[model samples]
Target: MEQESASGLSGRAGNAEPVAQTPTPDGAQIHEDYLARARRGSIWQMLAIALSLAIAAFSIYVLGRAVSAVSLSALRQAIAATSAEQIASAALLTVWSFLALTGYDGLALRQLNARVRYKTTALASFTSYAISFTLGFPLITAGTVRYWIYSQAGLTASKVASLTVIAGVTFWFGMAFVLGAGLAFHASAISAINHFYPLINALIGVSVLGAILAYLVWVTIRHRHISIKGFQLELPGLGLSLGQIALGVIDQCAAAGVLYVLLPSHAELDFFTFAATYVFACILGVLSNAPGGIGVFEAAMLKAVPVASEEALLASLVLFRVIYYLVPFLFALAFLGAHEGFHRWTSLREAMRGSEEEKVLEDEINPLRRWYRDNWRLRR
Candidate 1:
């Protein structure tokens, strides 16, 4: 038995090859690095959120001091005092603002060399912004909506992402351009914010404009795509960037005009001054990320428009949300519902047509079967 076993082992050793094991250790090391980086990113996000919350809290406290306590009746009186023309003008501006929003996607598509119909782009832009402005998060709301809409229009995921980034940058560029113009022109506009000297606002505005200018210069000179991490960024041409700036200006102006119209003319608030304050307040609200920037936005708006009484301003703010944010959100929901209903109706009609065709084909090929079905099934 021992001799037989020895012979078998010797044959096996001579003929057998070394078995190769999968290199799991190297893969494990790579996975560990990915996890580490993800954790670090999460930590940074948490820190940023915390910071935003702190700022929001401080702003809320300051705003509390600026206004006397208001009651429901007082708010109603303020609303009652607002004129019909003011309401209509504000609504009209809100409509124009949303229309300008569609241009963000339009201009972005041009930059990306992506061909999509203006109608599709308008739907995507309108619905996405309508949802995101209220939901208070772009990634979850607008980004997902864009992905869904753009994908059906033949845009790949990366293209959609690029489109989103470009469109977002366009809004900021416009905001910066307008804000810079507003502050540079009117230094004392929103001094209540940060208690800073008027010169600081002007300087900040210049810095924002300078940053946008620098971006344009870089795009003009390099004329090359930038790669960061694994994503490729194709910057728009100088002329296109200028167009983006124009879109932003129009959107911001319409948005600010929404409130400007709502305010009492006696408030003595001019467009440029209100635009500066509105832009500043908007930035604060965006940074806070509280849903609709609820308290933070109102506070900033109230603080910036010191001429308007707290109760009257509160009424305007309420109307602004209803017209600008809430009305559009409802309309978006209605549009989505109608779209889904239409698709469902189409599917059902197609299914019925398909069944009729199959039935006719079956009857044509098998008269005996059809007769049996007609007699037996009908009798049963």
Candidate 2:
């Protein structure tokens, strides 16, 4: 490669292509493959960001209309009606949910051929999800947080990118798993979509499950990486795939339960029934990229549970948001502050240690000079 570069620039200066280049399978220069893929990914990411913003705006506008019709006094009464046991139960479920989320980063690290201490992985995972869950752009919010933590720990930007992609796939696997089971087992549970056609809902559930199975079987058979644009999904060993699915299932269910537990006691909703609506609403929220899926999630939830009184239902939604979205967001900010403080303290300590070592060396080699320097500083 150096020989060709020199030959092309041999005693001349011009915008000349390299006289020699390695041809790729598609006949483009080998370097072009990387460039092409990067460009493709960048374009797609920009388009997605634009679409998410639009959806969020539209959702918020629609939600404003729905909210205007509800009685504020009744909503307040409904919130007051909630029991301490329910709030405690819901918050405990949130802890379990975040614990499962930590596993996502660990599994992604395994898939991306990287490793970090469990504590570091937990910090990154929790901070990212806590922020991104409210902020709505995981790529920007969660991806940046992961890069900051993982890069400092020695992983490169490219590997962190792959890790984020894998973590996201893990989420999908769980969502699909839960959705399929709920739909297949109890198509009538989801009040939002069941009214359209129960049979169709079950069929959709089957298709979702079938697709997940197909992916696992295909990867096992092919035994090759799946690459698209600039990203590659490394085919994990069968055990890792199963573990990812489990993590997703647990994480998704626990998160759903956080909101589910807040519903009025008399509401005719079972876990499976509420979870199906919850998952679907959560999907809409994610796709909208609305902050905390605020307007979008409430709209979907209210639409699904029309049987419930609006005032009581609205209060439950408000409490659910406080528990699942707002609280974690504030806590994540606190964690970030503490992390920064510790990092700064460590840096200061290391700097002081280096200075002390230098002073000690001077005193050993030239005691008089060291003494004078210290006395001068003290005098100053």
Candidate 3:
């Protein structure tokens, strides 16, 4: 009977299945595959970052060379010839113009339903303009920086991008209006330049058409039936579009005036003629991709103003830079400093709040109490 019982137990043990183990090789293979994918992704990301840095470095080097080649003596001569009163007036006007530029950002933000404070918006606008002027690449210029700042204001990336695009359109539309109106009314000026360089008009026309086509494509893509975060299409209507166009005219007129004021007193160029030349020169400068359009702007201005002597034209360009670029640059720097300081204070305040919360928890726990101490020790 005992032998039969023992036999039955051994049979039961034998019938029970073995516990399954995960295959080490399969686990290792999956880990290796994940590691390989990560390595490949990292390599590509590094390569892209390296390439971008290299391109930026090369561009800066080239711009530096161009700036060094400019005649400082001529620039100084121009500066000396400019009247102090005129310089002050030009400076004031330049500041006012830049303030108007802040409206571009305001309008864009309003469209995006991101109503930032006036001070914050002004800082963003000025800093962006300053960076764009200094960097010369609009993509890398102020827009990226503005996006960062605006993002901190609780805006999503897509909203910031849309605002950026709108602001860009505002700027370009103003430029185009200035260019078009200048060409239309100052046909004589256009005729003179076109007679000399027929290709200029063609190039301008092509650029304008290309911009329009690009905008249409962008709008079409955006207006397609798609939703992001429960939000449908959020584009400005025809009324806002017209308002943008009008703003552009106003902005460009002010910008062109900066150059016009710097010209020699005897220069036989009316506002329309000046605007035509200014727009062409500015377009050429932007195309050159030179920092602040430094050498490019000077050269183009020299070419456009045939009535003025080369020296006089060079002088005018220098004065224009001082009024429109340098002074604004200083103000932008001040604004950036203040902005950073405010952010630092806000961060400190957040840290203090976190510390206060920690203190409150400490007070509630009352670590000095025997039970609390015993509980804390148990937890540890």
**What stretches of model 1 exceed 4 Å from their correct place?**
1-43, 63-68, 190-194, 227-229, 364-380
Q: Which stretches of candidate 3 lie over 4 Å from their true place?
A: 1-75, 196-234, 364-380
Q: What tens digits encode model 3's per-residue C-alpha lDDT throughout 274-348?
A: 776777767656655567766656655555566534556667766788678877778778877877898999999
Clashing pairs in 1: none
What TM-score would every model get versus the actual structure? Answer: 0.83, 0.82, 0.68
Q: Residue 217 of candidate 1: its Cα lDDT?
A: 92
Q: All models: lDDT?
A: 0.86, 0.83, 0.72
Largest TM-score belongs to which candidate? 1
Per-residue lDDT tens digits for candidate 1, residues 155-267, read 99998988888889888887788888877767675554447788997788788778888888988896768785779898888999889999999999999999888886645
RMSD of each: 10.1, 10.4, 14.9
Candidate 2 ranges with C-alpha deviation above 4 Å:
1-62, 231-233, 371-380
**Per-residue lDDT tens digits of candidate 2, residues 1-380?**
89888978874566656689775477466569889988999999999888878777767776686678777887788899999998998999999999999999999888777879998899999999999998878889999999988887899988888888888888888888888888877786663555857778889889988988887787777566878675766677667788989999999899889877888863577787777778878888887767767788888787776545777778888998899878988999998889879988999999999999997887999989978988999999
Error of 1 at 277 (Å): 1.4
CA lDDT, candidate 2, residue 164: 88
